[model samples]
Target chain A: MLSFTFWDILSNLLLAARWTVLLSLIAFVCGGVVGLLVLLARVSRSAVLRKLSGYYIEAFQGTPLLMQLFLIFFGLPLVGIEVTAWLAAVLALTLFTSAFLAEIWRGCVEAVPRGQWEASESLGMTYFEQMRHVVLPQALRISIPPTVGFSVQVIKGTALTSIIGFVEVTRAGTMITNATFQPFLVYGLVALIYFVLCFPLSFYAKRLERRLHVAR
Target chain B: MAYSFDFSAVFDYSDVLLQGILMTVQLTAVGTVFGVGLGIVGAAVMTSRSRILRVIVSAYVELIRNTPFLVQLFFIFFGLPALGFRLSAWEAASLAMVINLGAYSTEIIRAGIEATPKGQIEAGLSLGMNRVQVFRHIIISPAMQRIWPALSSQIVIVMLGSAVCSQIAAEELTYAANFIQSRNFRAFESYFVTTILYLALAIALRFVLKMVGNHMFKRRSHA
Candidate 1:
C-alpha cells in the first residue's frame, strides 16, 4: 500500500482544479453564444419563436442540472450518439448555462425603455438595426454586472459535471478521500477551492452593482 | 443499431418513485421551514448593531453562497463521521439543505431588512412600540413583501438542487431513478421520466410558494 502525503493530495487536487476551471470557461463561452441566439428568438416578433425559447428556458430552469446531465449521458446513446462523460457534461452544462444566461440577458434587454425602441424605429431603423445600435448598447451596459455575477453560477454549475464522472475538482476530492480516508480534509479543501474561485467574481459583481447604482 | 424505448419498464417501480417524491417533498418542506427560520435569525443578527456578529453572519452567507450545495452535502454526509458525529443520509441531506437555504435566505432577508426606511422605524418607535415590536409590526412584513418573489425563486432552486442528495443514498427522486435504471437497464427512460417529474414538481412548488407568499403578506399591501 502506497501511503500518500498531504502534499501529494494537495498537488493532485490542484491538478484536477484545472479541469474545473476549463469546464466553467467552456460552458460560459458556449452558453453565451447559444444564449444570445435564444435571447434574440425570445424577444423576436414571431410569437412562435418566442414561445419556443420561453419553453426552452422554463424546461432548463425548472429541472435539476443533474437530471439534464443524466439525460444527455444516457439519451444520446439511444439516438446512436456515443457519449462520454465529458461530452455529456459539457453539452448538458452548455444548455443549462444558455437558458439561464438567455433569461438574464432578456431582463437586461427589456430594461431598455420602450421609447428607445420607438425612437430608433422613427429614425427609420429596422428592428435589428434599432437593437444593434440603440437598445443593445444600453442593455449591454446595465447587463455587465449581473452577467458577471451569473458567471459565478456557471462556475458552480460545473460542479455537477463531477457526478457524471467528468473528474473535476469535486470528483477529484472524492477520489482523494477514498484513498486517504480524510474526507473532512479533502471536502473542506474542495469547498475552499470553490470559494476561492467564486468569491472574487461575486465580490466584483457586487462592487460593479454598487457602482451602477451610484451612477444611476 | 436503433434502440427501442421502454418507459413502461421504468413505470413498473411507481411505488418506489412515489416514495422518492414524498421524501423529496419532505426534505424541501423541512428545509424551507427551518431554513427560513434560521435565515430570519441570521438576518436579524446581520441588521443588529454588533459588528463582530454582523461580520460572522456575512462570512457565513458568503461561504455558503460561493460553494456548491453538493460539496456542502458531501461534507456533512461524509466528513462528519470522522469527528464522531455520525449522521444518517436523510439526516445529513436535510441538514445540508437547511444550512444551504439558510445562507441564501439570510442574504435575501437582510436585503429586504436593509431596504426599510428610517422614517418607518422612527414612526413605529413614535407609536410607543418597543424595538422588537417595531421590527415585528412595522419592519419585517413589508421587507418580506419586497423580497418574497426572489425568495420564492431561491426556494425553487434549492428544491431542484436537492436532487443531488441521491448521491449519498438518501433515497430521493434521483436515487429512485437510479435504482430503477440499474434494475431495468432503461437508463434513458428512467432519467427522462424522473426529469419530467422534477419539472412538474418545480412548477408546482413555485405556484404554491407564490400563493403562500401572497397569502402571508396579503394584508400588508392592502392596508
Candidate 2:
C-alpha cells in the first residue's frame, strides 16, 4: 500500500468527484427517460402494460440496488455477456432511479386532476392526445419540486456504485483512507463533498415546494 | 457454455443466514425504537421557542438528510475510532441508522405536529388544561396518529438501509451472503437466496407494522 499524503488523497477524491457527477447525470437522464415511459405505461389504458410496468417497478424497488449491481456486474458474465463496472453501475443506478422516478412522476401526473382529463376527453381527444396537450402541461409544473428532490436520492444512490469497483467519490475516499490510514479525514471530506453536491438540490426543492404552495 | 447452478451450497448455510436475518431484525428493532425517540425529541427541539435549538436541530436534519447513509456509516464506524471512540460494527451501524431515520422521522413528525390546528391547542387551554397536559393530550397523540404512516415507511427504509451495515462486516444478511459466496464461490446462488430472504423479511415487517398501527390507533382505523 502506498503511503498517501493529505494532498494526494484530496486530489484523488476530487478527480473521483467528476465520475460521481457524471454517473449521477447519466443515471438521472437515462432513468428519467425510462421512468417517463414506465409512468405512461403505468397509467395506460391497457391492463397488460400497467401490470408489466408495475412488476418492473416492484422488482426494482423491492430488491436492493447493491444486489441489482451485483447481479448485473457478476451474475451477467455467467450468461456470456461481458459488463464493465461502468455499464453495471449505470444500469443498476438507472433502473433504481427509474422505479423511484416513475412513482414520483406518476403521483405528479395523477395530480393533474380528473377535470382536465375529462375536459380533454369531451373535446374528442384520444388518451395520448389528452395527456400530451392538456394534462401533462399542468403536471409538469407540479412535478418540478419532487423531481428535484428525488434527484438528491439519485445522487446518493450513486454511492452504491462504488461497491462494484466503480471509482466514484466514495470509492476514492475508501482508497485514500486505506492508503493514508486516515478514515476520519477521508470520509469527512467524502461526506462534505456529497453534501456540497446534494444540498443545493435539496434547498431548491424545498424553495420550489414553498413557492408552489404559496402560488396555489 | 453450460454451468449447473448448485443451490444446495446456499441452502446448507441456512443457519448462518438465519443468524444474519435475526441480527438484521434486532438492528432494525433497536434502531427504530431509539431513532423514533430521537426523532420525536428532535422534532420538538426544532419547534421549540429557542432559535438556537431550532437551528441546531435543523442543521442536524439537513446534514443527515443530504448525505448518503453509506458515508455516514463509514464516518461513524471508521471515523469515530480515529477520534478515540472505538465502536463495534453493530454499534456504529445502529448509531448511523438512528441518525438517518431520526432526521427523516423528525421531518415527517414535524409536519404532523404542524398540521395540528391551532384551534385544538386553544380548545385544550380553554378547558383548563396545563401547558404540558394540553401538549400531551391535544398535540402529541393526534400528531402521532397523523404521522404514523410516514413514520412506518421511514422505519422500513431504516430496515432496508441496515444492509449498508454489511460494508463494515456487521454480519447482516448481505454480509452473510458475501461470506457464503466467498466460501462457496457461489455468488449467484447466495445472493439470490439473500434477495429472496430480504423480500420475505420486508413483507413480514410491513404486515407487522400495519397490524401494530391498526391496533395502536383506534381512531386512525376508522379514518
Highest-TM-score candidate: 1
Q: Candidate 2 — which residues are off by over 4 angstroms?
A: A1-5, B219-223
Candidate 2 C-alpha lDDT tens digits along B1-223: 7768899999898999999999999999988889888988888787669999999999999999988999999999999999899999988988888899889989998998898899988999999999878768788788888989879877876787787789998988899999999999999889888877877887788889888888888765575
Which pairs clash in the backbone of model 1? Answer: none
TM-score of 2: 0.97
TM-score of each: 0.99, 0.97
lDDT of 1: 0.94
Predicted candidate 1 versus true structure: per-residue lDDT over B71-115, tens digit per residue:
999999999899999999999999999999999999999999999
TM-score attained by chain A of model 2: 0.96
| Share of reference contacts found in each model | 0.91, 0.62
What is the C-alpha lDDT profile of model 1 across A1-216, one tens digit per residue?
989998898889999999999999999999999999999999999999999999999999999999999999989988989999989988998999999999999999999999999899999999899989998899999999998999999888888889989999999999999999999999999999999999999999999999999998
Superpose all Cα atoms of candidate 1 onto the true structure and report the RMSD in Å to 1 decimal: 0.8
* Span of 10 residues, lowest total lDDT, candidate 1 chain B: B214-223
**Interface C-alpha root-mean-square deviation of candidate 1:** 0.7
Question: What are the per-model DockQ values?
Answer: 0.91, 0.74
